[model samples]
Target chain A: MTETLSIETWRLAASYLFLVLLMIMSQLLKLGHGKEFLMATVRMTLQLVLAGYVLELVFSQQHLLVTLAIMLFMQIFALITIFGRVKGKIGIGLKKVVALALFVGTSIPLAYFMIVVISAEPFYAPRYFIPIAGMTVGNSMTGITLGAERLARVFQTNRARIEEALMLGATPQEAVREFLSDTFSAAIIPTINAMLGMGIIFIPGMMSGQILAGASPLDAIKYQIVIMMGILGSVVFAVYLIIQLGYRTFFNERAQLLGNED
Target chain B: MQNAFSLRNVTYRTILSIPSLDVATGSVFGITGKSGSGKTTLLKLLNNLITSDTGTVNYFGTDVLKIDPVTLRRKVMMVPQAPYIFPGTILENIQLIFNFNRKELPVQVEIESLLELFDMPGMLNKKTANMSGGEKQRLALARVLLLDPETLLLDEPTAALDDENARAVFEYLAWWVGKSGKAVVMISHSEALISEFGGSILALSGGQINSFNEEGSVHD
Candidate 1:
């Protein structure tokens, strides 16, 4: 039974293999070096195999502290990724603050919904908390990165337009409102598309996993709905926070535009 | 009319330090320089795109830096050098700057008048991406002009045009200058064109306004 490749595992493995192969193929074509591809394949196999074992331990132990620790680490990693991607300087140290904001902003409501709202057992179950947190933080990370980057780029490129808007008697919000609108909508489209495709074109990994573990279709569907809502919430919160913070950072209290200083 | 745009010691860095210039009310001020001389940067500063590090930009009596951005944009609109024809029809691109319906807000008159201004009345509903360089420049100018800005900051408004099209654009701008009495600041390297228009010329070099010629000289 364990050796057999079920529909779920087969789909998962094939998708992962396809991505790894594509990356390898692109690199190979560029450098004519098969060594990197070989190394990457080996690394993927080992990492996934080890991660599977670690997940088994995590699932069995279900210790709240360990789960919380893992969640925090993922959040920190995501924050750093966002900082590097948006601000273009990894050492800017904005990640810690952003991490705190993301955690407090996303996790508390997620925890409440998972615990008090859904009433899932052990409250901090790695199976529930870790994956859900991962989904939420992952989406928020993308939104914040996109928002920050868009804000910086628009400000840099469209200075005349922005300033012209300002001089035309638009408030800071009024001046940048259209640009922000386009950017925010762009940042949220992925999450929106995921929601649109949920269970129709693609069965999410979590839902499929629950089904594989013997949960009924209805039960899996319920979890999927809850998680999807959480992801949407996270995206919305992140976008709002980043825009608010970005506006404050981009302009002064007297409505003067600020330069992109290090 | 009041002096609509003013800059006091307006120093900015974009590859070099840009010098300050004051534009009088109701006149065309031409920003002339060779390539890479920061004409675009000065336009951006006057338009309030980038804040000066150590000076104040005043619009009328109010400090432009302190003014709201949206208000600033409405007052001083810039038609960029390379027109960004957005992903729609010519009408849609113009409609992007406002919140009202295209049909409700004198779309045909605005479109017709602008097209008539540029003498391209037949190209109203055309897709902007497929349009040629001269067409795009005309469309971009039309869109900005529809906003009715007090200060028009045009970057290479005729760079892409042929002799005829360039002449048409200049004629349209000259007519508008005569009618509205709004400040028109343009960046042009064309000496012959500057001589023809005969506006005050501000020469930019190493980011500074090196010379100001009110008589519109052939050489800086």
Candidate 2:
């Protein structure tokens, strides 16, 4: 059993040399990404450093209120990010549905994973909760954004086909049925592809992080598998919720298609 | 004779402002107007597709807003101009629309006969993707006809047809409505076509009805 090797502050600074090399090469090639490279390097360093300090405090406290509050913050931040990330303005109705889906969708799987699967001591264990919450919430954010964007695009492009169905006595749900299926598939593909390519395509970040932190490879792989399942569950459920509820936003109370679907 | 739809003070944005109008059942209630004269909007209001900003629209004496929109639309089907021809065979398009409404599939013979009336005999298995503009319009009409709705709203139902084909379609529509005592509210750009077959014509100008044959339905 070998002890995990820790990088001291001075040694960690050496990583920046690789970024500098990339930025210099880009500048030499006139690829026009040198500034972007430099900014990304600085941003990553500052963000990770702040996150590490905050996580240390959160882990030490282990207070239920503190744990829940941080999760809530993560959820809200993810909600705002989805709004910003989606291409179209998600009308207020869909906005509410997205908010509800993110909260409920992420929380259900998270509660089950923490309380039942890991059975973390006292159930609010920050070490177990925060990382898992971050992964599930982050993945769900991506899924919801994709789902929302696809839903909006369909309404725009397929307006005539949808209205025709409506004219043939189709319900709003019936009119958008094919598009919803398309949206759901489009949203979940990235998550599904990652699952297919796991380990073969690349070692996942979580598994690598655990191995570096001195966890056994067997234990790390097990955690990765469960966390991956948790992420898939969150993304699928969140996307499903958004697809089902978000589309109704394009229709009024009488199930008539709204002309202003921006 | 029963009025299929009656309107009073129905205003929808700047597009329509019909003070009063009545469409009697059991005849072709033809509507004529230039494009953007609120002809289509009037049809939409009849089936409760769009709510009027003011005034009540009554469907067979029931205030349209009170009826469930899906139920109302099922009974009063409205086919738009340039109707969508779905990406499959004519049969598939018909089957899909029936599927959407949860209606039972009509017999193969029944479907073939309807297409025959629209001059699309032997088109059941023909791919809709290759249908001409006129054929697609007829296909859309035949699809709705299969539903056998209580009322039909058609926007420019014969706009793409040659006179011969258009005459055949109009003749069938007259027969179809006469046989069942059903009603039709059709918007036609051609005044002559609508005037001849249209039992009680309502002409719209700038979103207002300039003329309506209030007593013509019973005579027709």
Candidate 3:
């Protein structure tokens, strides 16, 4: 195997030239975003370096508890991001569904991938488990956020139509059927488009990273394919769970639509 | 048991309160008050769209809380003040209601006759998207009326109608009630229309019963 060359400190520092160029251009144009750009770059460096140290420690420990803790941490972080990033207010009921979908939707697929697809012996091996779980959870987080937001928006807009159906003796499920289908479609479209554009439109960041890390091109491509499939499965499952369970939150046990959705 | 709806100590969110009210079967029960009188809230309670905060609302002999909401709505349907017109032809709007209840659609001739009753003739294929407010109101009425629910609930069923058309519509409702042996609970702001056709008129003031006229006559 050909070992990839490592960048030295000075060489790594040279990468800041790109940011400096961007800031100079912004200044010349009077864009006023130079501070934001600089702050963002500094924050990214700190976050990635922190993640690197943590991963390095976990890799050395190789304990089941440590790996599981990391997995849980990733999941909670994803859940928080989903809740925070959604555009409008998410009702308490729908918020619970989002958390449930994110946890179960990603975990089940990840377990299956670890057991059957990759067949990791310990299954909680940090090196294999953490990256894969991160990918799965991250992709599903986006899908769930999109699904939750769209579901809330569509329900708010189509409320009168839904109520009219309910008055006509339609079940709550029947009333929101079309809206759920539409929300599911809207949520998953980004993932589908990414899939369509995978090889031709852009080589994925993971595959590029793997190749840069001295893995064979063929090996990198194989990992990319499996990871992409894992992502798609996770996203579809999470979004499906969200739309199905999330809509029920809008209604009561008696099938009466509750007060206004947040 | 002869009453279609029996309400006792019903109150809903400062919108409606009825200490004791009975809507008789086989008659047109008119409810009237100015806006914010909780007229629509009463209809919602009857249809199970909302449960009263405090009080029991019974349908026929059964407490509505014990019944499934979907089944309750099918048996007692409502048409709101500004009815929603689906994005389709008039025939589709009618068919969609039957679809909701999992009942078979009526014959096209039946739908045509209903439209004719509402002063809309030969308009089954016309798109509902372009319909006028009054036409949409009538189309909504035609849709629910075709379903043949045991009790019909209306929220200002003729606010969009002219007096002549409103009177004609009320006459048809009175005739339908007499013919079918079912009941109707309608909310209207116009006292003259209620006085002319309503069998038992109810007037609400600030969500409480201000007057109850059993002879269907409005009190001066």
The interface RMSD values of the models, given in order, are 5.5, 2.6, 2.7
- Model 1 chain B worst lDDT window (10 residues): B97-106
The number of clashing residue pairs in each candidate reads: 25, 0, 0
Worst 10 residues of 2 chain A by lDDT: A253-262
Query: What order do you get sorting by DockQ, best first?
Result: 3, 2, 1
Model 3 chain B lDDT-worst window of ten: B211-220
CAPRI classification of candidate 2: medium
Model 1 residue B206 distance off true place after TM-score fit, in angstroms: 2.4
Candidate 1: stretches off by over 4 Å: A1-70, A77-101, A121-221, A228-262, B14-20, B100-104, B215-220
Candidates in order, TM-scores: namely: 0.69, 0.95, 0.95
Q: List the residue pairs that clash in candidate 2.
A: none
CAPRI grade, predicted model 1 = incorrect
Better by lDDT, candidate 3 or 1:
3
Give the chain B TM-score for each candidate.
0.88, 0.94, 0.95
